[model samples]
Target: MSTNNIGPKRLVVGAHYGLKEWIIQRITAVVMVVFTIVLLVAYLISGGASYEAWAGLFSNQLMKLLTFLTFLSLFYHAWIGIRDIWMDYIKPVGIRLTLQTLTVLWLVACAAYAAEILWKV
Candidate 1:
């Protein structure tokens, strides 16, 4: 008797992140673009190129919140892209995990620094 390995009988593999990760990447990109536009507008309207004017722009509480949110989105976006790269190209499980761990640590540190800078503004 012949057997077929298709459809429900076929084994499914891979990261299974096609739709979800694609959506997240797009969303993060949009968030970053919006933040950039907002920052650009604010900078243009600030009407000065001095250090004090730049500081004053970030000094707003609303801007600070938006900045932090953008940073978070950026970090998350980086994480997803890097994680996918490691998963796809790194064959060794141990090395892939190590790289992923380091990526997480670096992104987290950046996020912390971002928060500190934003709050200090």
Candidate 2:
């Protein structure tokens, strides 16, 4: 008995997250860019030249929601990119998992802090 390891009989193995992650990264980036544009327009329209003016700009419920969502998108974007880096560069499974875990924890903390500060405005 024999086995073939070339041509169409070749077996390929990998932890591939090819298309889905690519699409997610693109969507998240677009969301962040659109949010930035919206924020800039809002600021410009409001003439946010003072502390009170800045506060007033963010005081609206819609603005607060959009800000929170943008923060979440930013965090998720960072997480995906960092996770991919760890997965690609760190060959050891334990180290990669540990780094991914730490990344998740840090991003979650940042998102929570962002929410708190955003709502306070």
The numbered model that scores best in lDDT is: 1
Model 2 lDDT, residue 27, Cα? 91
For candidate 1, report its TM-score: 0.88
TM-score winner: 1
Give per-candidate clash totals. 0, 0
lDDT digits (tens) for residues 18-95 of candidate 2: 777788889989989999999788779877678888788788898889888888989988888899899889999999
Off by over 4 Å in 2: 1-16
Off by over 4 Å in 1: 1-3, 7-16
Q: What is the lDDT of candidate 2?
A: 0.87
- Per-residue lDDT of model 1, residues 1-121, tens digit only: 6566676776666746478988998999999999999978877898768899889888889889998999999999999999999999999999999999999999999999999988987
> lDDT values of the candidates?
0.91, 0.87
